[model samples]
Target: MKTDPKQTLYGMSVQELQEAVKAIGLPAFRGVQLGDWIYKKNVLEWTEIKNFSKADIEKLAANYDLRSLDGSEASFSKGLESTKGLFKARDGHFLESVLISQRDRQTVCLSTQMGCKMACSFCASGKAKFLRNLTAGEIVEQVAWIQRKTEKRISNIVFMGMGEPLDNFDATMKAIEILIADWGFQLGGRRVTVSTSGITPKIIEFVERVDGRVRLSVSLHSSKPDVRDELMPINRRYNIDNLIQTLTEVHSKLKREITFEYTLIENINDSEEEARGVVKISLPLNAKVNLIPYNPIREMAAVYKTPSKERIERFTKILMDAGIHVTLRKTAGREIDAACGQLRLDREAVSAAGEPRTKNHEPREPAS
Candidate 1:
């Protein structure tokens, strides 16, 4: 088997890191030191490994190269203080990552896959269909690239950017292990969140693997099967009831609060009745509802619209009145086409047109 040298620092367990050092003819103890530099110090170049002998450092560099993203193009949110980088992978594939600077910490949302297969009606990621699953190194490199450019430590990471995380379970979990491992990123488990679109078997697998360490966010758009099937095609395969059952099982086994991401769309699934249904579904579980007003996309305009502010308030009131914890996530980067896949699509159009293409700021219809 050809060993993957670019094994993501975000995906390796401590023992795995030790194994990597051993492969390079270094003492196992060197894994701990390397881990400290990778995670704690956040170093990339082998020369940064201060304790390693010059010959050993040169050997390590020659044998293995750390995966890092080279930002080909970038767009920043002048209004919200966030930047999205269009990174060119070594393989010439393009992936996107966002760095959002908030009051205290800067968080980078990383993509686990190049394109998405889920085909959520409101999301822009799957517009090009599923391309490929990102390697653990590619996923981690998004963070490293953004960190290097901004010179800010990423306080949190969300697997909500592109691809269904649970669909890429092994790489996803390995990335989480790297983030939390002492030899890796050394981040607290709670600071990392993995979002999935109701992949039940993987939820069970996650429960078995994580054991209440990392957080989970499930995209629960609508409680009705018909509505969900129309919005998210994945619902047709997994359905809502089975998904809820699996979430319940995972919660029971792990004893953690899972977040339910409810993207409210106008006239489709944002009624008081639906809000009531949301409460009924969530009342039984230890979960919080994150209500995101639909991020309007030009391609998806005919299919979806944001509910009136009054309607959103009414919907939120229903959840809060029902005593269910809820939050209305303010849509960030409205100035730029900040939706997950918008940046790359614009870049593609520009390249194809062979000119500077103007961005359509007006929200368009969602993909069907």
Candidate 2:
């Protein structure tokens, strides 16, 4: 099937809009006006452009198709708490996004790529290996799709879904820009965060460009070099020292507190000394630690066990006593593979007898 040329709306930046208007026999300044309407107005339909003449809207609509990534499949939490799902692209590649509704806020966790290259031991996203990155339009479409179904407007976004935001750095940042642009979603940059699995160089790249406007969450799953190297294979490439140096540079430049996500696995990295070591290595960056109890993943289930709630609380207290800011993040949507790296598009790749095979999970609910 031929992809729509009008899909240009997804990847177009402000300047590109100016060029587009001129090419379509319209005034260059009209591009700026149209951009303000489409992005700032958050209109997904070309007819929503009131400033343009009816003919102008017709021409644009004929050339470009404003697309939305509707929820193809949805799985809610056991009791209607959270929902997760695979949002299919026009090309049939599935990327994961979750709508998490809390009493105070509604946050959408979006994926930037079809699959992931960073094969962290505990994440299911890496199981299918890397696929192509999603365009900025594709990224933003996930939010628009979810907004239509929920009673509340999405208040925040987290780039902590299937793929590494930094791995698909260009598209990821563009999507963020679209979300925060005065002519776009108008969400504050501070409300949207991009989590990385230690893509060291990209961390610096993000810090420099963001000007302390956006939030950064680094996946620091382990403190020991060898353990981290084993748990997250990306560590072997970026390692801990180099990662620390880059993070320190970011902290120095931005003077912003970084968030370190430590997924505690039973008998893995949840000891008192391990918590102390986390503080020792992380203090230089003035980072806050987010202790995550391990979510049972298909591949890592045999090798890892979720730390008990008592253990998680004790570990968090150790950091707090050391004057470190810490929060033990309660796992959301546990009934439906709610872990950061648990969204994989392998539902049909199981055994045929219909007795659910436990490889990862036998297709749990999405967007719970």
Candidate 3:
């Protein structure tokens, strides 16, 4: 297919890749073959795509990049369970994708963009300067990158890493499509969750586009509109009312109950009123609240501490008493700067300073 010479083919679905190759005069079946090579075989090079002539591969290469592990690096935590991968895009900027392994699940959280512009004060990724939204291929390749690290197949995919998944709407949705397609990653929609910081319209649009296959997680740090406004600037724009209304309307199409991810920052949002407010949000949409003990980013450490266990318990009790399902998320990967965008930030800082960030396998210091 006549494509942007700069475009990457790694993330395309069998249908799209077929069209791309067919557009360029390749046999239609080559798309299926390419899909097998990329998704099934996890091929890193076009040369690895056999049966096609070297010249034919070169022709395909002119219009697209294979986007293997090249120009990328990773840092693993001490146990080898958690890994933070930094993939350098064609533009030379790096983006983050994390592997968080616990119990039976090897979940890989993907970044939809290079850096983020969401500006959530408590999050490392949101604090970053916005670069650009990653292409669908770039987004999907994050999984393939993490997949190469371990033998266990990834159990889940979360758009909970660096950027606001909703903000990069098209690429995020396309990536999800590629991930869930049998010709691609073949992951069930239930295993993929797209977390948004309350972008109401996109929420509805995403619901319709995915048709309730993938899970939807909303970051409801505080149920109070005013407090949420302060915590997530996005709330100021979408607000609580708009979000609830949108989700309620979209409820008819959702395949699974929604999950509201609550970051429990000490004193900041752990009040009894906040817990009740979470109940209010959860009950209407048949949602469950996942209480996250806020992982403090060093830059915001003094202001945003994880609440004490007592306070977390008290908060969880409120939801439990209300019969609203909730789970307290365990903190992970502190040593490797497992917080979203922390590694990319460190990688860029070290590169800018002309030094290495850390010795291999050892966790590096997070941003100050």
Candidate 4:
């Protein structure tokens, strides 16, 4: 068995930081100083800390590596103003993060895993092979990198990028801790949303663990069991009925609104019947349905087309008439292949073909 390398200092909790300081023959107070520099100050390099002596700084640098995003591979959406950043992990695997700016709100979408295992037919993230789970530090670094680069406070965070967040349970929760900690990013729990593809057991565990402090969203593309099973493979294990039941229990216990992400894939799950099903499921759980018109992927574009505006309106009207709260999400960042896993796939393809990586802003084809 091969031993893993030491953990990065960026993502450790304050308590963990204290332990790290103890290991280095430093006073426990030094850990708090380290936490402040890394989390609150968002310093990417060890040398940025001024409180530590030069010898202490050098000693710290020897034991830990500062992992941050590669600015060279970052891409910005032309009209939308959304930015997609590619961070190369220490192991040389690349992960992607997106900074989405809409008017006053600045939201950063973070990936919990290098690639996704959930084979959602509509998502490009699942098209690539599942690589490995990102550690807590790696996840936190995504937000820190965006904050440092754009100089904008991230108002909201959504685990809606490249992977199923619930699948990477520990790291995701630990990252949340760093985000919500006073000495860290200091974001409110409500500002952070963890979206999952109906991971039943994990959802229950999340509710129990977090006590519904953070916001939750379910990727419920289709309400019909057969259609859902076809679109999201995880639905087979945690079916729609059970998922709804779990969410309903959570809503009753917490009295909070849950978000149901419904991706309208042309005629597939856009039918009025599916809309009715969405209303049925949402009403019971005090959930609001977010209607997303599908972003056409190159591989699945021939099979699936974005639903016409008319179709989307009709579906929204049906849900609204049924006394369900619904919002039609405007698709953004499509011009830059802003969909999850697309930028990584493009880079991988270019590397495999022995072509120089293009840094031009021209959008590759959409994924998801």
Error of 3 at 322 (Å): 1.7
Clashing pairs in 3: 1-20, 1-23, 1-24
What is residue 247's positional error in candidate 1, in angstroms? 2.0
- The regions of model 2 sitting more than 4 angstroms off are 1-6, 27-55, 68-71, 341-343, 347-368
Which candidate gets the maximum TM-score versus the true structure? 4
lDDT per residue (tens digit) for residues 34-70 in model 3 = 8888887777677778978898898899877777335
lDDT against the true structure, each candidate: 0.79, 0.77, 0.83, 0.84
Candidate order by lDDT, highest to lowest? 4, 3, 1, 2
lDDT (10s digit) by residue, model 4, range 1-368? 98676667888999988898888888989999999888887888776888999988877777766554433255766775788887777665678888989898999999999889998887889888899998889899888888887888899999998999999999999999899989788998889999999888899888887776788889999989999998999988999989988887777554458999999988899999999989888887768899998987777889888999999999999999988889987777777787789887776676567666566663333221
Ten residues in sequence with the least summed lDDT for candidate 4: 359-368
Mind giving the per-residue lDDT tens digits that candidate 2 earns over 250-359? 78666467899899999889998889899898777778888888888777778989988888888988899888988876667788777654545454243224455574
Residue 348, model 4: lDDT of 65
Query: Mind sharing the TM-score for model 4?
Result: 0.94
- Candidate 2's TM-score: 0.87
Per-residue error at 159 for model 4, in Å?
Answer: 0.8
Q: For each candidate, what TM-score against the reference?
A: 0.89, 0.87, 0.92, 0.94
RMSD of each candidate relative to the true structure: 4.7, 3.8, 3.6, 3.3
Clashing pairs in 4: none
